[model samples]
Target: MDCRVVVEAAVPVYDVSTADEAVRIAISKTGEMLNPDLNYVEISMGSRDCPHCDDELEPAFIAADEGLVALELEMTVFNVERDEHAARIARKEIGKRLKNIPLEVLEIEVLEEEDEEEAEAADEPTETEPDGGSGDEDDVLPEFEELIDE
Candidate 1:
């Protein structure tokens, strides 16, 4: 059972513009150089995206001209755990490695949209449900066995 990690991070910045600059800073000396595996940075006038990460943390980094700019970055690592618990453990360890980030400087949000997506997809009607049948069990759902017998 292979597991994957999705990391989203954004930091308030100033005097920065363009994705290339952000990328340079991200992979540069003191900024995000620690996370060598860092995959991307998104730019929105001042923000950026890796174009390589999983969820496309376009929302991660942001920026401004004068007041304060923000930079967003996203990344994904594969085959790190054996299951959900192991994944969580790996995440905790990774979180510690990222503790140097200042909350006031950067904001990181790692949402579990995969589960949400799965729930949304599961809500869609399956083939067993007739086109117009209600959700009730007694609502005359189609049965493969009945069709075969017929």
Candidate 2:
């Protein structure tokens, strides 16, 4: 099963005023920190979905908050278990690459192709009932009344 993960991170910049500047600095730092051997992983600020049409849109940086820039990283792993681990590895590498800048991982969302059952489950609302047994009956609770007293 193939799994995909989208990691959203907020990196703080002290003197950056514009989103473009912040993105430029982030990309540069990422490039410096990336290992040549792990070039198979794809990292970008943009997504594969098209904004205007059904085509791919150009990558651009967006400011999440004042003095902070948001980054979106898309990566593929072999299994669902490896999604979070891969994101952590990428975060660690980026942090090591930038010593002065402080990077904070905001969220890691795992995206996998879901089957019909999974989709239906996700769409449906589940009703949970509270425990039916009242606490008044102590004898039928499985433990001895004296043991519970102790």
**For this target, which candidate reaches the highest lDDT against the unseen true structure?**
2
lDDT of 2 by residue, 33-129 (tens): 5557445545566333466788864344344543454556554555545656756665565556555554444455555557756977655644541
lDDT of 1 at 116: 70
Tens digits of per-residue lDDT for model 1 on 70-143?
A: 33333333444344543454445444545654312133234455887898877777788655344675544457
Which candidate number has the best TM-score? 2
The clash numbers for all candidates, in the given order, read 18, 0
**Model 1 misplaced stretches (Cα beyond 4 Å):** 12-14, 29-62, 65-82, 100-150
TM-score per prediction, in order, is 0.33, 0.40
lDDT of each: 0.43, 0.55
